[model samples]
Target: MSDSLKVGLPIKYALSYRHKPTADIFFPDSTYNFAPFELVSREYFPTVTNPKGSLDSAIYTLISFEVLSVQELSLPVFVRDNLDCTRVFAPIDYVRLQGTISASGEMDTMSLKKDTQVIPLSQQPNYPLIFLFIIGLSFLGVLTFWFFGTPIKRQIKLFRFKRRYDEYLRLFQRLSRATDDKKKGLENVEKAVILWKKYVERLENKPFTTFTTKEILDNLQDNRLSDALREIDATVYGGIYSKTTASSLNILQELAESLYRKHRQVLVQST
Candidate 1:
């Protein structure tokens, strides 16, 4: 027997007899009066024996029992042989077993203590890291705009201005070629001047579209712009028959080119 017995474990009990038995072996009724164990299996083995030329038969009984509960167990065992018509006390008088029901190993059932406490758990988001990541992205965006955004914007503005300037130059050339016809030359000059004013209004964010020719010249404070506009307006409105010379139109073109260059310089410096 082990020092400690685990519940549900089987314990074997065996007994051998010198003479053949008439009936199967069994525990007495008293054994079940307070049964705390189950009988799992029972077996009997018979053998012929020879002692000093005398032959006899012997029987051995083996019983397997499983412990059912935790308690101190004591049992008294008695056996009887039918051939002798006699009752005898078993060689083992008393069987004692003791153990606990509490879990001990992987195979044992789990037991809970009354005082055990359970703590609640929760997951929290890392707000600081998220905020830092957002700030880092914002700073990167600003730096990118500072380094590359300005140059791209300037290039686009210059391209649009150059296209408009080319259109004005072609119109001026047509006006100069129409010098032989006074009315036709004046009409082309009027169109070129109007187109130039509209482009300047857009580029400078000015009121050139609403301004009179005199007002435009005053706003610009350029003597060359004033003279050129006056000559074109005289031919268009005053019905003047005087032809516009190529030299006079070239002066106006130079003035427009100079103004475009000035505005472009301002854009580049601001970036």
Candidate 2:
């Protein structure tokens, strides 16, 4: 490559390695020098930022790891970062690349227009690259529920949780309306509790639903559900509760609202 055609941000053609989602090494297309990846998660959308609280113009990669000791497994981690397409491409040879008009547009491939400068893969690294060098990265690491376990096994659990939230919302809405049939309304509330217990049993990776009303209420106490759950227990075990059947419905709807709000908060923070 000639120094005259020096590389910098916004290169002509940008190329990077992509590995198979399941394993670590590059797969058979072998044509792309791809690698296999163990997807602890497929929903990851990692981002990078700068020291002054501004995001870097370039994208970067950071490897997140947790070294746990029986004494202290959780520690601060600092390490090298991931590839930056803009900066990483600057030095590479790009004979043909669909061009970029502005700073934020996608990097596309165009027909080869000029003579190509072929460089051996081994020699490409001589150029400049921006990498992440950290002292401890684990502090900012968002350990998906998968890293502690496996997504394959936990997928059903997550699905059930999402569905239960939706169902709880619907059931609560149904309960909010005034129902003259008090007995049937209580029955509906009971079923909603059943549905919640079943979902919590799965989500907590335990038999929570089987824990009886008292036990379930105890477990959910810290989760901002104590009052509502107590009311639910009163309805189930006692002949009746202080709140009317419609009020019980209100409690159910309110509990669902609180949980869904929390779940959304978690998802937003994660993204």
Candidate 3:
């Protein structure tokens, strides 16, 4: 036994015995408890046999973390029998513990000084995690645009179509109501005609704005359109406002509504 052992340091202990038994014996494995100390390693020598007896020996490496001044330990070996195993214990051993301490001896309590100052540490941002989150968000955005871009565009176009059509209807109807006034009626007619041309051009993606009434009839190839434009043109050119002017405006409005529905259906089906 050592006079004193430092904490966490390893020490070796050995045991040996001789017996005439025929059965084999096994030294302590990891399952064995070395209470006051912890096991580090184990080394065993083969049995030596003579006619008199068989000798077996084993060494255990151990360490202790306990603060107890005196620690005791004992190891055991198992002897196999026909039915079960029996444990044979070695004699007890003792070791002394030595704690770490400064050689300066005790301090004078009255002379001791203390500083109470504290420095605060600034919090740091998790830049890597922030960057990863931004990248993930950007990737998700790109994926959404890639998968749904066409549908989004179709929806925007449909919305614009409806909005523009509504605006045209509101303006044309307002001007049509004002056509009863002979003072502004002729001017209103010209404005209404221009408005219709622009609306139809946008709706059908045609050049109706530049087209003359004859050109419009030639392109549309519809007798109703020809008749309606003839009435509207009579009021526009001859400076006349009659019941036919109002009917012609209604006819133009119906044509525009029909064109709007046709184009809207095409967009819906594509979506």
Candidate 4:
């Protein structure tokens, strides 16, 4: 038996039997039990009759799977008689097991303690980027208000002014047609004057509704405004509705359009 026996590696062993020339000898086959050691291969040799006796030998290739430090095995041969078979056993042989991996001689000096104080760090939120994003949004709002706020307000005011002016022109036209009837001439002229006063008051942000015609001429200092209001007053108080009065009413409408254009120009320049 070999002193160094590695698990799963094949071990070679020879089995021999010396019997009489006429005797029959046979080695154990697959029916025999070889526990812990598995038979891999077998080699047979021819019988040699050397006058001493007939020698029969065979080699077995075996492997052991057991982890025991020492492994023992024994094999047997059979002798055949006329009516029976006899078993002849060999002496028990042992082999020492060898490990596949070699260990370091200084294994006792190695440390095995664990580091229990190592704490996993939790992921944190990115506050700096969030704060900067908020600041950027606020700054964008301020810039939008700063750059386009006045223009947007001016556009809205201009739209409202145009709507009011359009309504005034329509009502004034209807009233002027009413002035064609002699019975309603004074009433329509008075209403037209009130409408004009109210519109101009809103347009100029002034108290034109409270102002006398003379006070209006003083503030406006326009000769066309003076002539237009005088004509309208004569129609209201004296019941006059002539071609000249019609022409003067048209002049009032033109004057109002001119004031609207001037106000629009001022609004545009402010923006």
Candidate 5:
């Protein structure tokens, strides 16, 4: 509504009756009951500031609008034909741009203002929902697993058994160093083997008591360990004979230690 909006056509016009353009943004209807605003650029509304007190700083004039649930802002823009109007985006609460002018010679046009009510559409999806069932099922599965599957246990390793096996391996080294005589050495070796079988039986939770000679030889492993153990039943029971020597006993003890260490290493690696 300022006089700056008006201009004059050139006498015998060079550009054929051109007019200057003017624009202003408003907060609400012309009842002047709401905040007044200025159009900064496009739809970005800069507030029409007023000092609240004598020594106060400027503050934005906030406006409230009652709109439907599914609503968005629509702005009614006004401009002369030659002047380019860059359409602007606005927030959900915004209403309209009204104070526009067309300036020709003595043509100060205070165009009547009208509001562009923003019909609120959903800020969410407009159509029917999909994949909701999938989401619900996933939640259900998680809850079921939490309540039931969490308590159920699967197969697990027995740590104590593994530790005992390691101790047995070390025991072989300790006991062999204290061992001295040859025939007595073989006797000690047989007793140590019996202790080992008992350890395995307890660890494996199986009844391995009173094993037969054929059973021991059948389960014999081809490691350095099997020399005295596997050969024992074959030598004593099967009438197969050989002289037990101090050198042989030392060699057998070393072989047993090597085999026991190797087997314990396998168990440790697995753990």
Candidate 6:
């Protein structure tokens, strides 16, 4: 062998003979034949005996060795019969078999036979794309709720307020139509005024139901509202019925409508 040896590489050498001689061959174990290598394993296959006793179908041997150092190497193998007879001749002896190991370690390649097929692998899922799609859908849902939720809430509040205002106006009209009978008309007007005060207190978040005429005017800063309530109070409490009682009730109705319109306008502008 001419090239330098390398450590930890398995080098294999195999030999087969055509003769069916009654003998066993052994690989050399001395350092002279394998100086830089260590014997790893050996294998022998069953002899294929021919029915016609042909020498060509006989014994086969395989051996493996691992390179252990960097040094010159020479391998000599011998064949001997069971009767201690040795064959040092050309076809039986292999004394000149030699080589070196200098290449990097690599595994042997395997080639498939003709018409063999390989299975295809399945594709992997794209996780990033799926995550982005879910995020986009969530953002769209939040945006849609934010855009339409406010206007719907405001419209519902306005509808409820209109229904409540209509109820107050209907009661005022009922009182105004009863003005022909003095005691009954005064009672009806007093009830209507009390209902109006309670409704305004709820709508404006103030204590109008507990306020006197002067207190109501002072808290609201509206002279028209005060004058309208005073006229109704005089007719009911003082028993001073006037011909303009219906018009006084109309003035209270107008004042309630004005307050409703102002509140509605503020709600609309905010939305």
Q: Estimate each model's TM-score.
A: 0.41, 0.32, 0.51, 0.45, 0.27, 0.45
Model 2 over residues 38-82: C-alpha lDDT tens digits?
A: 112111222333343322121221111222111111111112235
Query: In terms of TM-score, which candidate is stronger, 4 or 5?
Result: 4
lDDT of 5 by residue, 171-208 (tens): 65555543344455545555554655665455435454
lDDT leader: 3
At residue 59, give the lDDT of candidate 5: 22
**Candidate 6 backbone collisions, by pair:** none
**lDDT by residue for model 1 (105-178), tens:** 56523574475688777988899999999999999989988889978888888888788878877876776677
Cα displacement (angstroms), candidate 5, residue 64, comes to 56
Off by over 4 Å in 3: 1-130
The per-residue C-alpha lDDT of model 1 at residue 17 equals 44
Model 1 global lDDT (CA atoms, 0 to 1): 0.60
Q: lDDT per prediction?
A: 0.60, 0.44, 0.86, 0.84, 0.42, 0.63
**Which candidate number has the best TM-score?**
3
In model 1, which regions exceed 4 Å deviation?
1-147, 243-245
Q: How many residue pairs clash (N, CA or C atoms closer than 3 angstroms) in each of the candidate models, in the order given? A: 0, 21, 0, 0, 5, 0
The C-alpha stretches of model 6 lying farther than 4 A from their native spots are 1-146
Off by over 4 Å in 5: 1-158, 182-187, 203-205, 220-227, 230-271
- Residue-level lDDT of model 6, residues 95-196, one tens digit each, is 222346435766454653576689899999899999999999989978877898798788888888788888878876787788757558788878778877
**Per-residue lDDT value at 71 in model 2:** 12
